[model samples]
Target: MSRRVKNPTGMRVLITGASGTIGLALGRRLVEQGAHVVGLDVAPRGDEGFEVIACDLTDDDSVTTGVPRALDLLGGLDGLVNNAGIGGPAPAEAAPGAEVRRQLEINLLGTWRVSAACVDALVASRGRVVMVSSRMAVMQLPLAAAYGASKRAMVAYADALRLELGTHVGVTCVYPSATRSPIHDSTAAAGLSLEGMSTYEPLEGVVDAVERSLLSVRARRDVPTTRKGAVEFFVARHLPRVTDRIVLRTLADRARSGAFDGAALAEGVVARHAEEVSR
Candidate 1:
């Protein structure tokens, strides 16, 4: 039988990005379930049940010191939810270097830094680590290169962390599909829309997944927040070319309709076709 970790009652947990939608959802749930929750974010807010720590994950000193501070505040950590991230759409090559770096700094390196800071404490507590990746990590889509790359890298990092931590620490990577949140605003600002993308799932479902990952003894290494995400993950893995074609078609139609700035997108499509032909 697979081993299991009990629900987080009376246990202390830390959630990064506590100001964001998913983080807030998870925090409220954890608090309701009797766990002492510590929240860390650049813009920490007043969460009634959570002790908030103002820390920028991208700042080396902030993460290095902030995590230990949270540990002190919470008494100790039984779980760490790495839920902080940013999102936007930009053609891969056309996207500014700084823009891509900003996402990577927060979504990938920031995650690594925070996890590293908390690893020793997590090991001591036999705690779980929940990484909030995205469905885009498993499947590439149009006009979102930086966002996709950061999420994909997050999954890879989680995979390695799980193996390394072994039985001492449980690591779960949750890949939430598009959700009804401010992320859509960012996507729109970046010149894209969700019209052709998968439907947004509710925030509660993603929170539940995080809870399950923390409590399940035999936790899955990779979890899709919904059935739609799971099926899409499978198709992306087994039928990549088909997925690519579908995405390309959608982008092509969007470009033809002048939905957003399609100049970069048209070039991107042409570039992709050329690469495929070469292959």
Candidate 2:
């Protein structure tokens, strides 16, 4: 059943990946809705409406210290937005094992760290936790193996956490289609590309959805669909093996032509990766 989330006013939300496109927009929206927001990012702060801090999620100290500092600065946290993640868009050879490990560390482990640290506070406040996953978690994307894995891991984590926290703290995992943020470029820069990736929706829409998700009690949300994403969803579940074959064929064709744009895709993947790394 879908749960309705009320307006977030006079509430406190700690947002990680606050420097990235969606993260920044969501923070802005939270503030506009009269909620106190504390932004955590990997990059150095350059001023966003709410307080900004540098913390590395992959590191132990960052989670322990950063989470508390965020709560302290905001006085208390009523909710947490686990929006940080990384994706590598490179051919298997070019995308190193170490790099994929790092992606998992940031996307999965880091998400777990940050959310766990705030669970007690959320349980106390009856606040929600928003896990910003990707549509890739639902549909397989060619040439974005690491990205899909990380997002899938997050989906599993959110589901587990929801069952654990059932009927007390709300947990929402959002699966959004392609969004034009530095995140898209980050994927390309990281040497990874999302096959059939489409340019859809403004950054504002993602943030607005996050803001609305703040009040949501549902366990999952699949945001507005993109043409490709819609088709993938419409077809994939009923034809998993067939869809997999189609994705592989498309990738093989691109590889044969030597026309795939890994760099372009990596740019956003890296952006998504880099944002998640921020403390």
Candidate 3:
């Protein structure tokens, strides 16, 4: 059996992008466990439980300022969950140069700023870092060029940070398959939709992964830890031509299905997927 660290009740945790799906879920889970949680976001979270602050992650000053504000509110942080992200479709036939750059600013650069600001605190507390990444990092997915590339780079970044932070700072990178999150907005913004897109993992998969990381003694965990290799194997086995055809067909269907509202779809799909996976 894997070692489960004794629960650190009343310990503090700092969660970035707390307004998001997995972020909110993580925050609530921690709160219920008796941990003090501080949330940083660019927008308001409908979840009222966590201590929320409006901090801009893309700006260095904002992150620098956020550290103290978070530490002050929570008294100190025992963990940090970097979960802020955005997604979009890569226009078929068009290179996703700018969008990729933009995504890096938030996913990569933003993470850099936040982590740099929190390293000392994390070290002092012997805490861990959980980075929210995506399955696109492995390639072979359609319309996910920008999100994929940024996530790909983040994997390397997290690995290096983990090695450097060593023995003290635990770093875990989480990769989720097409999850039903605010990413639906991103897909639509990119002129794509999830029509005919039948596959997705529940947000709870990531929530449970990061939750385990917080209680972990070592500094790393692959979110949905046991499932990564199997999922990647399926993708690797499929040729690019086959994947591309699926993307084209899916996108065509999305275009025909009219606009999609993310919430309703996520609720119904997530329930079904969770039941299927549980079995």
Q: Largest lDDT belongs to which candidate?
A: 1
TM-score of 1: 0.90
On TM-score, the candidate that comes out on top is 1
**Segments in model 1 whose C-alpha atoms lie over 4 Å from true places:** 1-5, 261-279
Candidate 1 lDDT over 152-268, as tens digits, reads: 999999989989997799888888888788767866764577666567788888887878887787767888888878888888879999888887777666655556554444466
Error of 1 at 176 (Å): 0.7
Local error of candidate 1 at residue 96 (angstroms): 4.3
Compute each candidate's TM-score over C-alphas.
0.90, 0.82, 0.78
Clashes of each: 2, 34, 2
Task: Arrange candidates, best lDDT first.
Answer: 1, 2, 3
Residue by residue across 1-279, what tens digits does model 3's lDDT show? 147664858878898888888888888888899889998898866565978888888888888887789988887678988888877665334555766667878988888888888888888988888888866665445545667777878888888988998778888887676667776776665445554553577777768777877777665545543465345635544665665576556544453344333433233333444465568
| Per-candidate local distance difference test | 0.82, 0.73, 0.72
Candidate 2: Cα lDDT at 5: 71
Clashing pairs in 3: 170-219, 171-219
Ranking by TM-score: 1, 2, 3
> Model 3 — TM-score against the truth?
0.78
